[model samples]
Target chain A: MTAAELLSLTATISLVILGIAMLIAIIRVVIGPTLSDRILALDLLTVIAMGFVAAIAIRTGLMLYLDIAISLALLGFLATVALARYMLSRIKDEDDQP
Target chain B: MTALLATVLGCILLLLGSCFALLGAVGVLRLPDLYTRMHAASKAGAVGGGMILVAVALVSFDASIALRAVIGAAFLLLTTPVSAHLLARVSHRGGYHTQTTMFIDELAAASPSKGTLEQ
Candidate 1:
């Protein structure tokens, strides 16, 4: 019932929840019917990963880990944008076929 | 006393944030179509991640660390919607038309081509 105990308890629970979320997102990535679905699932995975990183930082009391979370957010955005552009080009190429 | 209060607040934030994240994952897994899945993944997922980041800021209680955490959360919030919009537009242009079960087709209705919107 101490505050430190409460903090650790919540941190552990958060980690468990994030892990399950990541698993579900992986399932979507594996069985998603379309390319967009898969990409969307991947994006969810990255967000879940961010939550994991934050939870760990809270547990460890290492505030520096937040830097990794920041970098990850940027990287995920770039990756999603790149994938979308790739999908667009592929579709355009298909249309150009005689 | 102040330390205890901070810890208590941090714990609540952590639990709330994680539960939101779990809900987002479930929505992504169970939604019937790509568009609906995207809706859940983008909005809920972003909010969940941002909340956790904010929780990190609260627990740390260091001014510098708190700044970084808030910055990361804000960046996450800013980018998720843009990326979702990009994905949706690309999918639509790629001929991934909306399902027939849906009652509305705003893009198609607004487009001159009737069914397909312009790139």
Candidate 2:
């Protein structure tokens, strides 16, 4: 097979796998017992989304999509950090109540 | 020849990356506690996403694309750990610890007051 054909096939398969991973992360978020579990699952979901963007960049020959992936990573990190801090403050308040 | 080789390598990396991502997701879904779930998801997910980005760099064969791809991957690698640590620390302070899974409490031992607060 030609190189282009091989790359296309690989990207297709990768997209399928990433989609499955995304589904699993969603399941975790849905059933997670605690706030922390849901937040962790959400973080994984964003990372998998980045993989999706990368795979699309490979398939479509659009290098610009890599920029989207980078920006998404930055945003995801900021969101996770903010949520964690929120949880910390909430817990500290509960601790102080007693 | 170089193009073919690069494509082959990128294909391999793509497959490896997707598998790692799937593993992380499954771990997050199946792990018993928040800490173990974060342990599996954060490291594996970051590596998986980074590998896919690197695969993009390998196949593109252009300096600019390679630079952007590498930058994205590096950004992912650097940020994932920080977020994971923050989440873990918050959960620990919130008393999400599972007695069966955790054997020691080093952070708690270091600060007796914090340990008391955990309980």
Task: Give DockQ per model, in order.
Answer: 0.62, 0.67
Model 2 pairs in collision: none
State the local distance difference test value for candidate 2: 0.87
Give the per-residue lDDT of model 1 (tens digit) for B39-81. Answer: 8998889889998988888888789888888888889989999
Clashing pairs in 1: none
Every prediction: chain A TM-score: 0.94, 0.95
The DockQ-derived docking category for candidate 2 is medium
* TM-score, one value per model: 0.92, 0.93
Q: What tens-digit string does per-residue lDDT give for candidate 2 at A55-77?
A: 99999988888889888888889
Q: How many Å off is the CA of B79 in candidate 1?
A: 0.4
- Cα distance off (Å), candidate 1, residue B50: 0.8
Best by lDDT: 2
DockQ for model 1?
Answer: 0.62
